[model samples]
Target: MTRTFRRGGTGGAGGDLDLYQYAYLAGGGLRVAESAVVSLTERGTLSLGAARLRVTGEERPEHPVELAVVVACPRSKPVREVIESVGHSSEVDVIARRLVSLGLVRRWRRKPTRAGRRRLADAASAGQVPAYALRGPAALVPGSARRGPLDVHPALGDLGRALTRMGKALDDDRGHGTDSSADAGGFGGGGGDW
Candidate 1:
């Protein structure tokens, strides 16, 4: 977990990154997108509901991720579609590349570097980020996580439920193959004729 830096890059992007970076390092692009949505809707800049997300004001978001969400929803669009689209858009990719250059993430495997991990840990400890966000995508993987009530922002109750449904749909799409032969052999070499 130790990373040696060059002469000037000691702090790894000026000692620490902002909250959005922490969210991305903790989970992925989706986490950042979700956080932005919560913040925007809470401020009344955006209206997020189960069916649609609409921009209500000209509130230009400070974060690139938030801005991307706004751009994606120029008109009233399905909340699920907007969140997923913005989460996987070019904005997140740009942030990923920057994290790599800053030595906060490995280029290929895409795991956090030492500094990245420490930053996220510190942010989580300080309550700057949510515990669920720190849990990464697993926390959103539908049945994998209990369908308990989420204590989210008042304006984001819809967002929370939408995210849950989205995760369930993704989980279902991964494997609904009931045929015994479809996934009979475990994904291990030992299951083969060894």
Candidate 2:
């Protein structure tokens, strides 16, 4: 399957700033190509084999659940590390289990060594420890050029930004409460209404 996405407009005054894209799947599988490109547009169209797909909606705030998956999707990591990286210990386990059930990740037991057992004695349960590994497709979605331990594909950068924005928004909401009407408008003295 070939996936192409195109985002509309250039960033400038009076130009639309919203981002949009389409992802298509064809013949029940994705193909790897050196020159493959996926373009995303504000009003983009997607074609998958003989089927056409359309996606529409306002982007929702990024949740920890999705962030956890993205963080753990690139490689096999110790369960504790995955939990720590996402900072959602309780939720990460559930998400990992679900991913395993969904066939997106695989879970296995790693027998604890003497040193490992000592290090994790306080943190882990008896016997072997559980670890998770991303399935081929989940890891390959980021492409072959992805680098570093924490790097995600360029295509997923927007999602990372959304997660950051959501964290800031939640922090602000906690500090100032949910009502933001006070800052709804600014400048001039006309009650700040436009």
Candidate 3:
């Protein structure tokens, strides 16, 4: 699948993107590739795989979830460093897990597979670790690079977008609290208006 993308968001202007051409754009099973490229600015113009998606929030802020990928990609830093930078958050953990599943990253405890070792060896032979190995924030846990960005499913994009929206909505709603004083019941705080 191929996807064409033009970037003009908070991340600044990015080059036109084609998922087929750049599978790295996606991470995990979230989503990858497309039959055609669509400008992310055009809402409802893009269809991920078979799922229909609308790019509603063009100017919406970049979600922490997105940053999670950035942190794990080590193209930024080591895994431990990323965790330290982002601090501990369930959200970050979720993103890390998803990233790991997508094969965008590897945990440290696992052994590298033949292919992984071969790739490492190849890099050693080349006298330089490829950017993918050095730049991307990956733990390289005992596992093989069996999966790459191409392995990410396109639907994951929708999931990421949805999670982003949900989180933002919650944050927005938090500012307009409407819960009753007694609604808290015994949870340890105020309750609803009861």
Model 1 lDDT tens row, 97-176: 88888888889977788977876666676665654456643364333532334553234365566555444443444463
TM-scores for every predicted model: 0.63, 0.18, 0.20
Give the range of the ten consecutive residues with the poorest summed lDDT in model 3: 28-37
What is the per-residue lDDT of model 3 for residues 1-194, given as tens digits with 9 covering 90 to 100? 11233333332212332222122222222222111112221233222221123333323324443334343332322222332333344544554454345443465432333433443344335433322223222112111122213445344355344323322332233342233545646576546687
Candidate 1: regions farther than 4 A off: 1-13, 131-194
Most lDDT-accurate candidate: 1
- Model 3 per-residue lDDT at 124: 39
Ranking by lDDT: 1, 3, 2
TM-score of 3: 0.20
Report the Cα lDDT for residue 40, model 1: 73
Show model 3 residue runs off by greater than 4 Å: 1-60, 66-87, 103-194
Which ranges in model 2 have alpha carbons more than 4 Å from their true place? 1-62, 66-88, 109-194
Q: Candidate 3: what lDDT?
A: 0.31
lDDT of 1 at 184: 78
